[model samples]
Target: DKRIVDWTNAQNEWKRREIVLKYIASKGDEHELYALILDNRFVHHHRSVTQVRMDLNIAERTFNRMQEKALWEAARIIPANVLVEK
Candidate 1:
């Protein structure tokens, strides 16, 4: 029972993350924004900010600002009720 509960929690967390990623990827400047979020290490393991900036050819300050904005948007986009186990 305990192990099942733990596994369920982990699975739910992974699902929640996937939902958020999909939501972000679907809405607005999808390609650029998603790439910015992914490349700048918003959700998954990613390249360092410096490397991402170089790869994306974005300014450091702009990248930082976008990363912040992306996080804020992701927080707002994520459903509050999704975490509640059904």
Candidate 2:
């Protein structure tokens, strides 16, 4: 079923990767983190890009740009502005 293989799955996969990246980053495992990201099952995998781009509702370039922006935001070094008084 081609319809079943459309943007919905791609979007879901992308969201899953978004969370997974955050989770891995939290774990602080430098060695396995790269491998997990590169694994084919993850949406960010090298081979999945074509299908993800074509199937997603957004344009390929837009999606790529958004992903890059998200990575930058996640990696920003600034600490939280609001400090707890306790």
Candidate 3:
């Protein structure tokens, strides 16, 4: 059970990185991308941030910040008209 838990956690982290990559390639927002990454079942398999950076060729903090920025921009780009007036 311990191994399974560890494996699952690691896998989730890897998936998070993968999701971030996909979102970046697609020009997705940073904030939304991060939120998406943090969502359950996505974090990544790697335990150390350094390992992630080396493997993914990106600094973990940088990736996180970018994702956050992208999400913020995405929200701003949304059309207000799309929202129904109260």
Candidate 4:
């Protein structure tokens, strides 16, 4: 059905890209990098943002900035779909 197809498409789009996201995160600072994958399904570790923040012992504002940077970096670096013709 439509829901199944949509879910499959969503999963497909994120799955491969998540691998690249981890690679990108690994290229940065250790704690800073955690913002990219913590509590993410692709990483297989589930924790709330506050829990992660507490684990990291960082202030909420700092965590917010880190999360924003991680997200935007992921957004900026992840490639958009392009049709390739052979």
Best by lDDT: 1
Candidate 3: what lDDT? 0.49
Provide backbone clash counts, one per model: 0, 0, 19, 0
Q: RMSD to native for every prediction?
A: 4.7, 16.2, 11.3, 6.4
The sequence of per-residue lDDT tens digits that candidate 2 reaches over residues 1-86 is 88878777767656655654565456555423332433332345565656655644547687566555544443442223311134
Q: What is the model-wide C-alpha lDDT for candidate 4?
A: 0.62
Cα lDDT of model 1 by residue, 1-85, tens digit: 9999989987887678777777677776744575456535844656688877787788999888877877667667667755343
- Clash pairs (backbone) in predicted model 1: none
What residue runs in model 3 are displaced by over 4 Å at the alpha carbon?
A: 28-86
TM-score (C-alpha) between model 1 and the true structure: 0.66
Q: Model 3 residue 55 lDDT?
A: 49
lDDT of 2 at 71: 43
The whole-model lDDT of each prediction reads 0.69, 0.49, 0.49, 0.62
- Quote the RMSD, in angstroms, for model 4: 6.4
Write one digit per residue (lDDT tens) for candidate 4, span 7-48.
998787667566666667567585345534443522446667
Candidate 2 local lDDT, residue 23:
59
